[model samples]
Target: MSKSNRNLFFSLYWLFFLVGISTVLVGQVLPILARRFSISDSESGYFFIAHFAGSLSGIFLYNYQAQKSNFIRTILLGICASATGILLLNADSQVICTIGFFLNGICAGANIPAVNMLVAKLSSLRVSSSLQVLNFFWGVGAISSQPFFHALSSDGSVLLPTVLLAGAYLIAFVFIYSHRLEEKTEESSRVNRASFWTVWRNPIAWITALFNFAHVGLESGIGGWLTTYSERFAKEGLISATPVFFVFFVLGRAIAPAIIDFFDDNSFIFLSLLVLLVGLVVIVFSSSYVGLICGAGICGIGTSAIFPANMARFAKIFYPDASKHATPIFVMGSFGGAITTYSIGYLSDYFNSLKVGIFVLFANTLILIALQMLVLLGLQFPKKDKT
Candidate 1:
């Protein structure tokens, strides 16, 4: 990579780093936010729903506009939107905070795909490996998030962090907006007119999208609820256990490039899911704080490679149609986050045990494992067209 290319990559990394923090911010602070607003666990699910719903909408927006606009332009817009969301998120009102989360989701929805697509386009030769490296920075952000929150607010108020995050986005916006992005190639510039149905008609496309739905649901459910789960189950310092999970999560991603190279995409995902299942089993069955922490770390490592591997697989399998398929796949991811995160809270409220809620993750993981098995079997069962 040339100096310019390196600069762009770092910028993208920084953006994802910010994205990492935003991704888990609600989950990390869910308890505090609940207390502040005097809301129950089920009510709190609204936050996740609003945020992810906005994210789904944003993905749709990006899908429509990506061909019409440049990646840098979409990215800049997302950065600005994220900053605005953070500022709103810092507000005292719960309604405003919900709106802020929605905007934040929009930012994430727009930028996540935009950044990933940009990297894939730029590093066409090594989509999987490059995405692995790119997502490693996301893990860095996630692992640092709890510590970052603690460092800024001794009382657990999100005000300081949100303000600082908003400021950071402002600075990044100014810099990235002014930088001269590389010119788009003819391939990048071509319009993809395939309708959503066209993409959905492909069995590979729906399966891949559903796989992401399950994968994200599992990942986000764990990240979002682990803190509360610790507080309820193991009498350990909630903060301590939550970050341990993310720490291993980061380490897993950092090593994914090397680890994944040994196996093909389906093989890697299958193996990763098995590890994830083990971790989930440990978490659900374990009684002690040590066991909880250990299970979290194991789960993190297990989950590290699944998303990137699947993304790389999608790119390779879809090739030129990858962009066409990107929207629904990503939308399902956000949708999964919305439904699963909310469902966790709802189930906890219904069953009156966080552990029961967590069973949802366990179930989703099994579904993912089964889905990957089907993919491995080389199923090409596309949806039938109308007669």
Candidate 2:
């Protein structure tokens, strides 16, 4: 990569790192949030709903915004929006925090896909590998947020963490906005300009989005609920376990750049689903703390490859039209996370056990695996040499 591309890479990577934190932030803090807000499980579901709704809207809005603004300005706008959300998130008022979350949603909806588009367009590496690198940073951010905050404030000082995260975005915004981006290729620009309805109307695009939906549901559902599950069913140090799960997640994605060399992307996804199923089984049945942690860690590794690999495949298969597919897939991912986050809360409350909610990850895994098969079958499950 040239200096400019490298700059874009680091900037985009860090943006996602914060995004990962925001994505998992709710679940990590749910225990504290419940106490601080005097919130019930049903009401808690709204938090996920609000954030994902913002994210979904942001994805489409970004599709629109990308036309008028350059990437740097789009990113700066997203960071500013996100920063506002974080600051409000720290406010003492419930009403303020509620608006904060909606703003956070808009921030995520706008930022995640927008930064990602820059990374995809700017990568010096293979698109598959570059995306893996991006998401690996995301896992790093996701895993680190819980423990970092827990270390900073065990009593649920939401302000400190939110402020810190918001600061990161602001700093990143400065770095990216100042860098001069290379002119976009005409082909890339044309593809990016594809009508939203055109992509929405395609079966492949819907199928692609569903894969992301199920994948995000599993990733967010597992990441969000694991600590709570461990707290209720296993032990008290669930906060510490957050990083342990993501260590394996990062490990999986770190190695994903090379996995493409050994197997087709869809084949890797198929195997990953099996791995995830095993991890889910371990999590569901494991009666001991050690067993639970180990299972959760395995689950992380299983999920690590899904988002990036699927995304790379989408871009590759669709080729020039890849730009059109980006927004909805991102929206579906946010939707998946929202629904899964809500489902876990609802199921856990209904059963009066976190374990029941944990089981939802298993169901999502199955759905994602089925989607992977559809992709494979649609493409006739390409041969080894073909990969």
> Candidate 1 — what's its lDDT?
0.81
| TM-score of every model versus the real structure | 0.93, 0.90
lDDT (10s digit) by residue, model 1, range 245-302: 8999989898988767667778788888989999999999997878988999999999
lDDT of 2 by residue, 37-113 (tens): 88877677787787777777777777676554355656677777778987886666777776677777776778767
- Which lDDT values do the candidates have, in the order given? 0.81, 0.75
Please report the TM-score between candidate 1 and the true structure: 0.93
Stretches off by above 4 angstroms in model 1 are: 185-191, 194-200, 235-239, 380-387
Best by TM-score: 1
Count backbone clashes in candidate 2: 2
- State residue 262's C-alpha deviation in candidate 2, in Å: 0.9
